[model samples]
Structures are given as C-alpha cells and as structure tokens.
Target: MKKVLLAVFVAGGLAFSADGAAIFKSKGCASCHQPTADTVGPSLKKIAQAYAGKKADLIKFLKGQGKAIVDPAKEAIMRPQLTMTKNLPQEQLEALADYILKYK
Candidate 1:
C-alpha cells in the first residue's frame, strides 16, 4: 500500500510538472501570444526576456498583481485575460511562469 501511494504521489508530481503548457493552451493564451513572433500580443520569447530572472514578477503579473512591463502600452488589451490566470493555484501559476520563462 505504501509503495502504491508513493508511486501515485510521484506520478502526480510528474503530471503537474507538465501542466504548464497544457494550462497555457487550455486557457487560450496561444491565441494572442505566439512562441517567437509578436501577434496580438508579445511573443513568449519577448515575455521571457522581460521577465528573465523574475519568475516571481511573472507570477504576480499573471495573478493581476503586477503591471505589464514588457509592453505596457498593450496592457489594456491583456487586462481582460487576467481573469483566466489570476485565480490559478500557486503551483499552477509557477508552472505557467516556468513554461513562459523557458522561451528565453
């Protein structure tokens, strides 16, 4: 039983670790933000650059607690989208930030 429980726990962590990309897609972030090109919004690469070494700020931004720094002029366009990210659990938020940061 203990082995089964340990395996389950480990599996869950693995799944959670991969959820960032899935969550980004499921949350419809791909529509505006491309991987490396600027479309409706800045590319993930641009975002990663802006938030490099600032994962906490990135998470805060996603939570709607931090202002847009990469493209502040376009922030209004992204305000409505915050509702999708603002309430994510901390772990999920961290994962999302990690995924975005990896583009750097």
Candidate 2:
C-alpha cells in the first residue's frame, strides 16, 4: 500500500512537469524565449540561472506577485504576458517554475 501511494505521488509529479512544458508552448512562451538563446525575451537558460534556488520566487513572479529579476529593463515586454499566468492554479504555477528551473 505504501509503495502504491509512493508511485502515485511520483507519477503525479511527473505529470505536472510535462504539463508545464505543454502549457508553456501553448501559451506562446516559445515565441520569444528560446531554450538557450535570448530573442524578444530572455532565454530559458538565463531565467533558470537567475531563478536558481528560488523556485518559490519564480512562482510568485508568474502569479504576478513578484517582480522581474531576469531582465528588469525589458520587464515591460513581459509584464503583459503575466495575465495569462497570474490566475493559474498553484500546482500549475509550481510546475511551470519547475520546468523553467530545470534549464539550470
């Protein structure tokens, strides 16, 4: 029974991570932020590096409760996009943060 519960927990975590990538793509995040290079927005690698060891803060930024730390000068360009993420459920927010942080 314990093993079954553990497996379920692990699987659910994986699902969230996968869902995060899907959500990122669906929301047009890939249009500006590349996996390793900056375009209109900072690269995922840059974000991950700036956000390293700060997952909660990343989630807060996604929720619009935190400020931009990656590219403060260009934050205006990304601020508008927060509307798409601000109301996401906490789990999704965490998953999204996890996905971004993984680039580190």
Candidate 3:
C-alpha cells in the first residue's frame, strides 16, 4: 500500500500541466486566444510568431509593462485582460509566459 501511494503521488505531480496554461484558461485568455485561428484577439500562434525569441517581452506584457507587439489594433480590448493577470506572483507570471512561448 505504501508503494502504491507513492506511485499515485508521483503520478499526480507528473499529471500536472503547466501553470501558465491553467492561468490562461482560468483568466479567460483562451476564449480569445486560439491556437491557430484569430478570434476576438489574435491566436496564440500569431502571438508566438510575432514574439518569437522574445519571451521576456511577453512576460512584460503580462506584467502590464510591455506594449502590444502582436496586435496593436486590438490592444484596447486586451488591455483589460492585463488586470486579471498583471498582479499574479512572479512564479505564476513565468509559468504563464512559458505556456505562451510553448505555442511556437
């Protein structure tokens, strides 16, 4: 039983997905940020493409410090979204950035 419990605990940690993806979905980012197609906002693929190799800049945006590099036209709509995520702790912000960068 001890061994079985250990296995289950290990599996739980392994089963956990990236924190950024969780934050994205919980914060309603996925509603507008699709994987490939544009919706209310640019898709994740587009954001990944535009911010390629610029993960720091992406995190900055999440922190409400960076400009809209992917879609300035829709920046107004996205600006409010920042309030939902900007105050997230640094670890969560990093995770969120990691999740977004994974789209590439």
- lDDT on C-alpha atoms for all candidate structures: 0.94, 0.91, 0.85
**With candidate 2 superimposed using the best TM-score fit, by how many Å does residue 84's alpha carbon deviate from the native?**
0.4
Q: Candidate 1 on 1-104: residue-level lDDT in tens?
A: 99999999999987766589999999999999999999999999999999999999999999999999999999999999999999988989988999999999
Q: How well does each candidate superpose onto the true structure, as a TM-score? A: 0.88, 0.84, 0.83
Candidate 2 wrong stretches, greater than 4 Å: 1-18
**lDDT-superior candidate, 2 or 3:** 2
Query: Higher lDDT: candidate 1 or 3?
Result: 1
Best by lDDT: 1
Per-residue C-alpha lDDT of model 2 across residues 1-33, encoded as one tens digit per residue? 999999999999878655889889888999999
Looking at model 2, which ten-residue stretch has the lowest summed lDDT?
13-22
The reply for model 3, stretches above 4 Å from the true place, is 1-18
Could you give candidate 3's per-residue lDDT for residues 1-104 as a string of tens digits?
99999999887764454367778889989998999898899888888888888988988999899999787987999998899988888878888888887887
How many clashes does each candidate structure show, in the order listed?
0, 0, 0
Worst lDDT 10-window in candidate 1: 11-20
RMSD values, in order shown? 2.4, 3.4, 2.4
